[model samples]
Target: MKIKNIILLLCFITGFNTAFANEGWINILNEGGNNKGILCTPAIQKAIEKASKNGGGTIFFPAGNYLTGPITLKSNITIYLDAGSVLKFSENFDDYLPYVEMRYEGIMMKTFSPLLYAKDAENISIKGRGVIDGQGKAWWNEVYRIESAKGPIPETKYQKMWTEQNKGIVYSPYYQRTIDKKFFRPAFFQAQNCKNILIEGVTFQNSPFWTINPVFCENINITGITIFNPHSPNTDGINPSSCKNVHISNCHISVGDDCITIKSGRDEDGRKYGIPTENVTITNCTMLSGHGGVVIGSEMSGGIKKITISNCVFDGTDRGIRIKSARGRGGVVEDIRVDNVVMKNIKEEAFMMNLFYDKNTVEEPVSERTPIFRNIHISNVTGTNVNKAGTVLGISEMPVQNISFSNINIQATEGFTLNTTDNVEFHDAKITTTLGSSFKIENSNNLILDNVASMKPIANTALIKLTDVSNMMISNNFPMFATDVFIEANGAKTKGIFLKNNVFNNVKKVINKGAALNAGAVVE
Candidate 1:
């Protein structure tokens, strides 16, 4: 009987321990003096520190505006802002200039002002329907005013806020601000060298600079998040630099700059580190009024590889899916797949790869061989009011290989302009254009046109122009404007020109230098 009583006592202790471990609710408003209205500056931080010291738990921010600045997240913590809670940054820049180690603007300079920042923390999350607004009016206005005067150079430094002191020499901007440049850095949420981050169900708006930047992090998941910054200049959404295993889904992002950018580093500073950005997936998102729907790099010094984008919408953007890298950026961008997209009112080309952005005539442009964009499977793409149909500007030396376009319909102003590329297959690609030829190919080899058609050209030129090509074959093809069918290859080296199973109404024969072996086969 005594032993039975001892067991009952043990059961009671176990139940009490479990209850104590679960009930760790620490409210910031209750920790300090009666300063209500959701003041989370020092009060909430103190409560969080105290709770973390004891053990880790959820520190709740109830509904209302919580004015805070630079709240660092620690290990084993989950900050759940209850629906209707608004975490706003302090307007004063002095509060954010704590001097941290951060990478900004393709350079590793020092400054302050990331609303929520944490480094090397494990199992951290910023989840809820709350809002983290980086009151960026002051910073935005200053950047606008400076950009007007200086013209296209970044003028802010944001790395000093995280670390103790700044040691590296930053490239000086052309002009200086009257206020401090180091104190004016801007990022809403910047997490570095972290693991296992889950940021979901938040409305992030109006950042001073790039909205969400997570660098060198892993095992990250960002879902159901909306980042909106309608203001101009320096408003990029969610740039994951040098990270691994990232998944961004079910998000609505419409910013002023590039909607989502992937970067390893840029220029000499980025090359010094030599860490490539890899293995990222962005799916099920809607973009409005950004530079590009998904951009790879102009600042890709380290390298970028293995990225997949699926099930997205690009409405009224400059370019739909753009891969932009210059000469100084010596990296390889390969294995990129974009599938199942809908575009409306894209002002520029739906797909563009510019290997020579800022090429100079005097000096050879700083350019890597237009990186191989193969295995890029694009399907079920429907578009309206596109300016340019598509562009494949391969390097002057070697071609961009193994690119396939499947099941695409575009109402464009201009059609495909392909040059110096091979092994490009177009399956059921119908592009309606009002200017230029239906297709223009130059310095190319082994091009297969299967079920490719163009309608009623306005330029009164040939439907398809083949110049300086080799081993060309046209089979089962229809050209609407057969005014100049099969323009002669003046300097082209044709091994065997095969024209078979083709149906042309007004076009009977092509202008060719070689012999048409089977001319009377259809209408001799």
Candidate 2:
């Protein structure tokens, strides 16, 4: 093709002027004839470097399968993949050698490079209707081998070890230890400390670790992407860690881990950085077959706030709207709102806030390491065929507070469970369960259950069970038919329980275990 004609064609294809178009289009195939059989890591890296030096342009990948290793992305560059293109990463672990500065499980360390990585860059993007396959089977097999050799993983062992190794420099408990960085796996796409990032219209598969990870980034916009990494370990779809102003929409994610997880950092590293992941919005996404549809950390020690999740669908996930943290990982998770969510076939709880993640049982004094969860509002959510409706398991030292749920409906095998929570309200909630009480409250205070109904009638079970609860107001609730008791309270701490205007039909008793005999307890 003539130079002028080729320039015009490139301009038309990229929808830009001739000068801007020709300068930006660096076709890798033209530079090095689509090296499908050989590893094209060096050639692609050269192309990116050349384009970046020539004032930042687009490195175009035409229709071919380019097998590569880790490729470091440059600033002011866009990786545009053509329709029939596939940038498949090499399976050889040695290719990702010479560990780079990255975060492994929220801990900052020198580790293997991700398939596509950028750090301290600006105006970077990966947009195309093409596929980026991580080819992560080898990585997954290695992890399995390690687990098989290391019998029954301890939950806090690694976190404790990492914290101990990096003590004084970080936080948590002070202990002397050393950590081996060999077990770190690479992510598919990770951009750290980048700004004005855009990722759109791409399909990702077989990630060794998290699919799309943006750490300490700002103004990230990810839209119209599809992530598929079924049955792969740690293949979280999108994990935005310590990022701000992130907007994710129109994405279809089905991964082995959480579909979309918001994080800051892990225990001490998180506290050291102390950068909260805030002002995020996720909408119009489809989540299928993951740990959680939208999760906010088992790793959020750096805090997370001011997030909104709306207009999403979760199908066949283990849980939906999961917020998990541990005792040592102390940070505030608040000001979150979830609305207009629909879920089906959830394997576990539809909504959960678990402060005791990983079975952490270390009894330490209440200090900066005590995690706090409060001010969460959920409305207009519906779920069917879930194993459990929800769980709010907070610690005794710091109870989860000021959570409200309205217009929510769920069908589950077990009902909602709240422990060590305070000032919670559930209004217009219809929870139907095949077994167990519709609501189980334990060691909680100042709860209001208004207009809540148990749709399915189960025999020999109370619709609501309370233990060591205080200052509870249960009003306008519709108890199921054949329920043995509408409300049952036990333990000496169960006091000030007021029940009024509740409809009890076919119930053997209104209050069981002589809970109404307590002082200041009224049932009318």
Candidate 3:
């Protein structure tokens, strides 16, 4: 299908009216009903209610600064802002009180409030060329202070005292419990369990917490949206938790946290929910200055599958593409495809697979890890100024298998470091390092390096190191380094090693004259 036709099909599938859609526009004027430079939340809500009653339409905010309180959007509504529309939140924290049904810290516990909310709605949207500012300095500072205190703060006293002090409300089952889950107020826009929704062409800023959260939703389409929140704490942009059939495209996200996070649930509660977030596609986006550009499963206990991310740019982030899951997560993240990504100035690893995350919790250093990441393909990538090229920390039991990296050119501060088991393949991949060795393989096996090229490092770095590896093939390889290759196989079974049509420069000689290097294991 052609691109336009595909988009049209997506629109049709997503229930978007290309034409003949009513222009439902709402304008909030001052008390005197003058149409400029004022905030009228009550008036806007009245307008939205009136419009919804009369077969829903768009609530338009014209080009001006309109300071308002928390407004609830109704079903069959589209809130549109004209260009230059600046919808500012009221600085008085009391305005967002009484709490709501929200998720905090991976728990379904509720507290405080969100800036804009729509619950159990159908065919809703918030789109336009405008800005929604969440005035989040007060809340972000509080979370940071709590985190720095180090001890578990009492949830009841905290929420009650904060509410009594900040003029908010406490609405959690832990409302009676002393030790409650730390609940910070949510971001500029949060919707729960809505269907056939869209949020396009809006600029969200300075969120109190995670921005644009769509939880337990279905058939959602978010396009042409720009989220910019540089506040502290959990200010993630576009977290689609437990949602199915979500498509996010043509968006620009630059936040203090993860740019796009996919979560099924968190910890035990997620496993109990047992609803896997599946069939999501993210394309044509630019992510900058986040913890991870596109992340999945730091809180993914419920399995996630069938995700495709293409034609994206990850710039100035801590990580480009990351999949992080800890030990207790009994979920499988499989069948993912990432193509045509361009990354620059990645502060950390360009591609990271951390199956053993948050080592602070696991006291005895878990050697046997799971949560397999298999049959994943990443291709047509060009990266520069990468801190680390790749780090795969797979399980000792089930190594990350059937993974391929093809047509990749990366220039990084450090090169590939592989740990644990492996049935990995690196085909048509080139790496130029600045500090570390080209490849470091420890306790891995059945690896194939086909048409791999490594540029000589200016620093003293080794070309390749294979320790306790079996059944490996290094054919059609070209490497440049300042030292020799090291292959040390302990009491492990032996398979053939082949080094045919290989080229090495600077100072490298073949030295794997062992029995494990038995069949097709010849170096020319």
User: Which candidate number has the best lDDT?
Assistant: 2
Query: lDDT per prediction?
Result: 0.71, 0.87, 0.75
Using alpha carbons, what is the TM-score of model 2?
0.90
lDDT at position 478, candidate 2:
68
Candidate 3 versus truth, CA RMSD in Å, comes to 8.4
Question: Cα lDDT of model 1 overall?
Answer: 0.71
The Cα RMSD in angstroms, rounded to one decimal, for candidate 2 relative to the true structure is 4.8
Better of 1 and 3 by TM-score: 3
Question: Tens-digit lDDT track for model 1 on 318-389?
Answer: 878887665555666677788888888888888876655545412344354223344455677877788887
Better of 1 and 2 by TM-score: 2
Ordered list by lDDT, greatest first: 2, 3, 1
In model 3, the runs with Cα more than 4 Å from the true position are 1-24, 30-39, 150-158, 161-181, 360-370, 457-460, 480-496, 500-507, 512-524
Worst lDDT 10-window in candidate 2:
173-182
Model 2: per-residue Cα lDDT at residue 397 = 85
Models, CA RMSD each: 5.9, 4.8, 8.4
Clashes of 3: 4
